[model samples]
Target: MTAPRTPILAGNWKMNHGPSQAARFFADFLPLVQPADDRSVVFFPPAVSFAAAREAVQGRPDVRLGVQNVHWEEGGAFTGELSVAMAADAGAELVLVGHSERRHVFGETVDETVRKVGAVLRGGLVPVLCVGETIEERRADRAEAVVVEQLRPVLASISAEQLPTLVIAYEPVWAIGTGVTATPADAAAMHAAVRRTLAEVYGAQAAEGVPVLYGGSVKPDNAAELMSQPGVDGVLVGGASLDPAGFAAIVAAAG
Candidate 1:
């Protein structure tokens, strides 16, 4: 029987590591994740760390670097904003969009997130679009509505072909960084909802091929079970991934 597609284990070092710390982290991380072995390992660091991350991944065929966010514009003085071209020029193959922090803290609206996704694709970078329900929404039994709402604008402006390049990360707001994880069943239901929406909008082929991951306190102990659930392709790891050993164990747990 054919083996399942190798799952991507992506880690986001959000606002935590500076260029210097990034250098040290990658130096240690790259060796731990050999290209052929951990072929789908990706690291999404703060925008400022792009150059350092690129250098860290240089000549390493298996590993790739990504940016946490990027401005939708091509260029111009948007002081403090990193452009899509800048992310691509820095050798980042992917860019994360609409993370919870950006949504809640930075006030990035659905319309704006859609714009960035289009720009990321136009700039030749894959968009790992994240969506999820908040604690209140979940308690109100509106998780599905919340996720669908998030996807509406994001998919509205993009073409069908672009759907294949987009990866969805369903992170329940309450579960993130709270040392709480959605049970595998809980995650699978949301993943299935996202895929159903993709199919309805982009057709079956695109929806089937596009990978939807589960994020939110994914640790080495639970990574495998979560991945085993229907529609849970991989993960967008946070805290557990900060440590090289724990991150490696999460990948190894995938076996």
Candidate 2:
């Protein structure tokens, strides 16, 4: 049988690259992503680059385009916000929601994130819903509780059958760009916790099929061990994604 979950290596190009840069970056990077392999590789540039990314990977079957964020409403009067339809129209197969940055920087409430997840799924786009605990939360030994809380709100908005169309990313707030990567064992334990929570809410099928990714300062060196974990399916890359070679190396490690 194929692996339990398709390994997904996604890049979150946060606020970087306009269309021109996006096209150039993809041109440089797409060749390394082999769709024939047993993995799904996706990338999200700033909203401005969705068009460019779609064009860049048009004929290449391996590269999938995603949007960094989206509005819950399909469209209408939400200036400065992109709707789920807008992202799909721009050629995105996935729409990232509830990332750490969105929560900490944009003042996005859990309720808002839940609505966005619903919008992404209803619009025929996969939702990459992110959940994580802050440094303080981790220090206080509340990481599991924090993640559980985040998952509850998002799960509340999605239908049981739609679970497969969603990806859950667990990114520790303190590990993001802090050069503090969690040990593989620690990350694995969290992934298991996520799986348990999923099973509790949506049943064993959802728990078994739903892919959970670990995102927090992942590099080529640690990627292999991370993937070897029973519960860690893939990763959500950040700064490393900006460098084509660095990202490719990590993908190779995943294999």
Candidate 3:
């Protein structure tokens, strides 16, 4: 049997928060959010403030530090880009690849994301790979297909042995930052599809242990209901995470 998946609540600070701001957030947030042994919490600060974020979470087992993005190449002339080694050196234990903004705004392709995933593994950091469909795709009745396509190449890059360490965040484009959240049933269905795809690529055992988190406008009010869904393992919080009390409430809800 597969081991039970550990629930993770990660805050993606995105473009917000500088070094001092990050430190302040930790000072206020550390006392507010207390994850249980079974739950894990991660903070993905902007690359610029990673060191401060790392220092903030120091000695806290439940809280982990992660980077927003990383370049696939180790080094050499990659202007304005952070490599996996740099991220790891900054005390990041995880990395977020294929975020929606990277794909939509920065033009990150599936192949590029695949390469980054490999680099993250080689760098000894867990990857929180983001996969989702846009509103247009969902309207066209191709949400699952789009997500599956996005996931295929990335999953193909990793071996079965690496499956258990991967975290997939399903953040539907339509729901992200729009104050609109997917119903628990809809989120569960997408998460289930993600697991099914993993099972097909790897084996059932490996797929069952992989945690699939729901993102996009996830807030304290809806956190419990979303997590209660069958395949909903955790959450990738956005705006709500920027606030200490709000995020803490969400964590409390998860526990």
Best by TM-score: 3
Each model's TM-score, in the order given?
A: 0.94, 0.96, 0.98
Candidate 2 error regions (>4 Å) = 1-3
lDDT per residue for candidate 2 within 161-216, as digits (tens), equals 88889899999999999889988888999999999989898987667889999999
By lDDT, is 2 or 3 better? 3
The candidate 3 region of ten consecutive residues with least summed lDDT is 29-38
Residue range with the least summed lDDT across 10 consecutive positions in model 2: 29-38
Sorted by lDDT (best first), the order is 3, 2, 1
Against the hidden true structure, what lDDT does model 2 obtain?
0.87
RMSD of each: 1.9, 1.4, 0.9
Question: Model 1 TM-score?
Answer: 0.94
Alpha-carbon lDDT, every model = 0.87, 0.87, 0.91
lDDT for each residue of candidate 1 in 1-255, tens digit (9 for 90 to 100): 324445788999888788888888878776776557633888998877768877878898677788888889888989898888987877889999999999999999988898999999898889999999999999999999999999988888888867768888999999999999999999999999998998888876677877888999999999999999988888999998788778988877666
Superposed by TM-score, candidate 1 places the C-alpha of residue 95 at a distance from the truth, in angstroms, of 0.4
Give the C-alpha miss distance for residue 217 in model 3, angstroms. 0.4
